[model samples]
Target chain A: MTEALLHVDAIETFYGPIQAIRGVSLEVAPHQIVTVLGANGAGKTTVLRTVSGILDPEAGKVVFEGKDIAHMAPDQVMRMGICHVPEGREVFPFLTVRENLMMGSYTRRDSDGIAKDLALCFRYFPRLEERQHQRAGLLSGGEQQMLAISRALMGKPKLLLLDEPSLGLSPILVQQIFEIIRRINQEQGVAILLVEQNAHIALKTADYGYVLEVGRIVAEDHCATLLGRDDIKEFYLGQKEAGVRGQRRWKKRRLWN
Target chain B: MEDAARLLQLVVNGAAAGCIYGLIALGFVLIYKATEMVNFAQGDIMMLGGFVAYSAIAHWGVNYWVGGLIAIAATAAFGYALDAIVLRRVIGQPQFAVVMLTLGLGFIFRAAAGITWGYDSVGFDTPFTNKTVKLGGLILGDDNLSIIAGTVLLCGVLYLFFAKTRLGVAMQASSQNQLAAYYMGIPVRNVFSMIWAISAGVAAVAGILLSPVSMIDVNMGFLGIKAFAAAVIGGFGSIPGSVIGGVFVGIVEQLAGYYLPAGFQEVTSNIVLLGMLFIRPQGLFAERMGKRV
Candidate 1:
């Protein structure tokens, strides 16, 4: 797997006394799209936060590009080529769209490279170019998400960590965003670790998938194989027929007896 | 003709004083914008700057220009230290705790200044002292003109700093969202300290300008309350609002002192502040507070 671009090995992270991620481990290979699928409150966001240095894991190491970055600050982590697109698209509302995109390249000194990336970003999301002078706060949800993704791309990151990019978006918009995500991975060769609750779309878009339940991974498989599983089809794909619930209830009752 | 001349003279005087208030309020707005802390010590920092410059000029017999530079550098260092050593520790704590800490620090600065320089008001010597420029029937003091020119120049430099410079833009981005700024590879903590240093340096300039007009003493810290009122009136977060608020407060105080009953000068700012709070709680240029989904 090309020595794995990001190796999050057996990391346990806590928020004060409550442990949010318990011995969770995952990896993303170079030029691959990896998705962590889970229900809400299943600690998917916690894993991404830990990997990106926003939260310190109590145990284990996060090796990125062959360096232990678990103890680094967020800015330091970013300098090492990891960019986190946080949950809820936390774009700088007061800054103009162009300024916000410029801020993404804050750590870099190569002006030519930055300018090139800026043009690339605008190309990826033409809406950003049309409203480059407008305040970011004025952008619609779909546009803001596009801006958020493009901003991360401006950093020229080796691995991008995206938390719930599809949340609260229309289905058509979600499809469009996923298409862009795939294009970014194929064209730019940037590794992506996507955390999402939209299991169906995530599995469809990703090459590999991990199923997180209650802070631990219960399933890991290639996206195509995982999509074909009966349990995944019934639970995550919402394929329950009209009589299926009753049949499953009777089957569970018999097992219990 | 005489009444019109008096009113013009009063307006000029008020504008000079308003410029000083605006300078001090700029410090408050800068610190608040960066750290979300109301630095009660802002006024005392000005007093400290005034005293420092006075000591350099009056006691050490340094050149006025040299003394002013020294005071600015010293005050900026002190401010940077305060944030790095003290305020940095209180980050993520309750807002009330940070406010009280600043209030206590203000008192400490006042007491320290009193101990070092004594409580007596001392004359502040400047090159502009006693120099007046005459234009027809009206006379303008060099000190007042200098204050006005200095305020305009300082504000212009600050505007360019925020609008044109890379570091300044990064600082503005950090002020807007620290976590997001950090995610963008901005050193947020260093930006906070830099904001403190700049605020202190500005406050020091205001103090040095003010001392020749009003004698340098520990009681000079009381001007902070007026500046605070200006910040509140301007909408706490806005920079230009601070200057406008300061000018508004200054004009109102001058008018109140001239036409109203005794002691009206003391309550004028508070009165305007209260009116502002009641009429438009969001300062004139309040940044739109949008909820992030």
Candidate 2:
């Protein structure tokens, strides 16, 4: 994979007393769009949190650009060019849209670069430009999601860890978000590690995929190959074999139909 | 005409005193907003500011203006250190634990002040001391006027800083969502320490402005109780609300003292505080949702 950009080696993360992600080793090549597909309670969010330094792994290492960053603080991880857009899009509700975007670039000292990146964000989401002065709390759910991604983009991150961008989004919006994600990876070369339950679009947009089941990687392959797997269809795609059609497996996940 | 002048005089006097409460309340609000920790020692910090100014101006023969500025800076440094070394350790603990810790810190500050600055009440010479200005038919003490003026200036700067500046907005962001601010590459822990410094500086300004009207002593920090009431009435979250609440408390106390019998003046703030709790616990300018104290 032309040398990995972020290599997560057999990490274990504990959320309080409960061990969330265990022995989960995965690698993302530079500028590659990687997707981790999992059902509810499979530790998808935990995996991203561990890599982003929100939850430090009890065991194993997260090597970013060949530097060991395990157990570092979230701010330090961010300063090293790993930005995490956490679950629930925790944007500053009181600040104006433009102010929220400015916050994303808080580490940067160059005014010109910040200004250019700001313009770039607005171009990506014209809706944000129209309401730059409006309070972010007042934005619709979809608009807030757009703002969330745009805010992360403002950091000019080398690696972006996005947790379920499609959660609570419309089908059209999901498609649009993935399309933009694809464009961002290609144009900006910001390698993305996205965790999603929406298997269809995730398989379509990502270059590589990992199937996580209960704190473990069950499958790892190219997106196209993962798409062609029968097990992937049954469990994630919500489709069964011809004779077993309409009779779903009890373990089948709730997919975006 | 005499009655009108007396009422205006009472209002100005009340407002001046209330500005002190507001300033102290401001310290609480700043720290609370940024860190969700209510510093009960905020009043003691104000006391320290005044005592530092006293030493700088009277003992060392520094200019009053320069001494006051130095006191503010020195107190700010103390506040920063207090957070970096002490309060920073208490993050993520229960609110009750923080409340108790800060309350304990207040007693320690008092004892420390007693040892450092002595038990006796001290006063400093300000440019406005003993001066009076006649505006039309009314006479106003420069001490009272200076307090009002200083508050206006400080509040203006704070308002502009939080509204217009990048670091100020970043401060707002840090308080609203710490994890998000960290993701933005802001050093949230450091930002918190900086907020502590600013809060301490604001408390120091209150101490300096209050020198002529009141004496600076180890017990001067008890005024923080009144300021706490002021913060509650201002919704505990809003900046301007706390100041206005202080002014309101001050003006009401003055009116009660003038109209009612003697000894009623002392209980007036407590009564107002209790009444506000009963009538509007959320405060006058409360946000839609309040974080539980």
True contacts kept of each: 0.70, 0.85
Quote model 2's iRMS.
2.1
Per-residue lDDT for B201 in model 2?
A: 98
- Judge the docking of candidate 2 as incorrect, acceptable, medium or high: medium
lDDT string, candidate 2, A49-150, tens digits: 898888899999999999999989998999899989888888899899999999999888999999999999999899999999998888887888889999
Which tens-of-lDDT digit does each residue in B137-188 have in candidate 2? 7899999999999999999999999999889999999999888898888888
TM-score for candidate 2, residues paired by index: 0.97
Query: Which ten contiguous residues of candidate 2 chain A have the minimum total lDDT?
Result: A248-257
iRMS (Å) per candidate: 1.3, 2.1
lDDT of 1 by residue, A214-256 (tens): 7888788999998987666666787776666656644532331
Q: Candidate 2: where is the Cα deviation over 4 Å? A: A245-257, B289-293
lDDT of 1 at B92: 89
**Leading candidate by DockQ:** 2
